[model samples]
Target: MELTKEQLAFFDTFGFIKLSGLLKADITWITEEFEAVFPMLEEKHDGSKRTMIVPFADQREKLCSLVDDPRIAGIAKSLLGDDFNYMGSDGNYYTGDTGWHRDGENRARRHVKIALYLDALDGSSGALRVIPGSHRLDDKFGVDVKRVSQSQTALHVAGPDVPAVALDVVPGDVLVFDHNLFHASFGGSTHRRMFTLNLCERFGEDALDELRAYILLHAHFKREHYYGSAMLRSAGPERRVHLEQVDALCGDYAERTKDLPELPLKALI
Candidate 1:
């Protein structure tokens, strides 16, 4: 469904929204796909730390098609325009707590993450928590949180101690949030199932440098291409609209990079 006027406004104002049961029909297959994808990877999650896979949705053709699902596409199209770029995705089995944090440093560009949690969750069970309106970089709340929490020494407290709304969700629900939004999850079991699809506004010719930098980040994934052959092979026109931009520059992404940025200390899924 296309977002209504108020829905758009809420995302713009609060930086996140939860759409319950939007993926209910596909949940069963999504569950199968999630289970199927992990064994392809050599890494095993022993409940010690977060286990992650990049280009997550592409691992299974069914999961890759989620980008074309009307409800999923609508959310991305509504905020990012018809020509949005499909940035990438991540799948995870999270262990312990995820400290409060923002996902990116680009202030001029905006991106949104569509998160799917495959298990029932609450604040104390790894439900996503967010500080509303925190994406407004220049605002007082945004600046203050960034200042105090960037080092965490000034706050001198744990992430869950900070005030915020804990978003409760079930298996079929979906959560969308601005990449700049301050969010975290805590008090969870060792194995929390989750995955995300990321989308962002199309860059203008003048912003190609920024676009290149964003594409370069795929280096950390240890990948030579952004999307998998499955995503590209199955993409129809609408999906192609989102995939074309990234495909232009990712052909030899890994070989081109002299060094990859250090992986995140804590894996974010």
Candidate 2:
């Protein structure tokens, strides 16, 4: 449950990293589960008649469970101490516009936010945008509330011209970043846009096993559909995924780090 020197360096400079296919099934389950509840939340429509803002808390625990993945939980433990709380949890939809903003607090103490993508994405497809190295700046520079329709900039920084990562998540991939890093996302491919959040009050362990298994299953499911076959890989010329074994394939991720820091066990949101 430790981060390598490279990962620490990347996080220190870039403010984020893109791990493709990190949590597939968990991603899909959360997305599908939230979409089912999206209609119940207050929907603000845009010019195209699509929901602009649909933040609901009815089933936040379900989505939050996806964030508590042990692997990701491990990352949090490695960076932040093992004493924190799940600050908040909910789902956000951006079929239209999302203003630029930071998820960090304005206080002197530092904090971070981790986002998990539920599907594939690219820069043009309303992918999550981030400002590299911005997390090191002061809280004011780290957080801005100007609220641009598509652009994300804090109070002092120039309009978000920073190199933003596309976050082409393959279902299981998770994006761990500092809240101070400016970020935004918009509509893309008519596909569902979903991600989970793990904001800390201090920092602690996460449910890596449950989280990792969910992601893997999600990716496995998608591959089966895309290739028009089932099986992680077939025994024939065109390898196919055997869907039957997918459910049984969730990895054996027992919580091994008893020494890891302990966070508030309260449910997210």
Candidate 3:
């Protein structure tokens, strides 16, 4: 996608953008397709495997095609750099019963999320809550917030005054967010929430390997910050090797995105 100067500037400052109706006719189809392949996620604390299953069987291929859309992936590449990779996908429905947290440590690279809302999302409907521009805080923290899963009561620390933006996502709208941004969603009593996730630029050669390894050994990589419970974490060397193998599949993704023509939003509609 060709990002206007203002759009680019917004992402740099706010850490996310809600692009309306990003799904269109394919919304129901994609959701149904992904649900068919959705696996029961292990209730581990770490962020690994939490988003492992891609709805389409040929997930990597479909992602490449989707990301190549000029209005979508092209802009992602522009902000995230051309070395982007398709790291994982997730389907989430919130109860609004939970509070705040971040996905920093779970992601393997500098991550950005292409969140396509399949249905309307609002506070009452368990819509997403975000700390805008949280992504920009990474450099100051001495750690990439993307890699930090815990900050000891950071949820409470974030407090109530932190302005909570209720996303009014029409079906087909897409939201691009920095993975490190501090955001959370409440659950809906009815209507399932669905979205496609993409992570850009694999920083380390062994990043995927590390993920695969962690998953195999630990079955869960627990992150205590958000859940206030253990989610999942890596374990043992044998699993680490397995993680390496799984990571290999993603290695070529960056190369694939290099020269494609942009997919504009107008064409998508």
User: Which candidate wins on TM-score?
Assistant: 1
Q: Write the per-residue lDDT of candidate 2 for residues 101-198, one digit (tens) a residue.
A: 66643343345666655556766666677767667655454433223323433333333344455565556677788876667665564444554454
Q: Over the stretch 85-167, how does candidate 3's per-residue lDDT look in tens digits?
A: 54445444422233555555444456677777666767657566677766665456324333223433443333333456767
- For candidate 1, write residues 111-134 as lDDT tens digits: 999999999999989899998998
Best by lDDT: 1
**1 against 3, candidate with superior lDDT:** 1
lDDT of 1 at 261: 36
Question: Model 2, clash count?
Answer: 28
Q: Can you give the lDDT of residue 204 in candidate 2?
A: 17
Identify the runs in model 2 with alpha carbons over 4 angstroms from their true place: 42-61, 105-107, 139-163, 186-192, 201-269
TM-score of 2: 0.57
Ranked candidates (lDDT, high to low): 1, 3, 2
Question: For each candidate, what is the lDDT?
Answer: 0.83, 0.47, 0.51
- Clash pairs of candidate 1? none
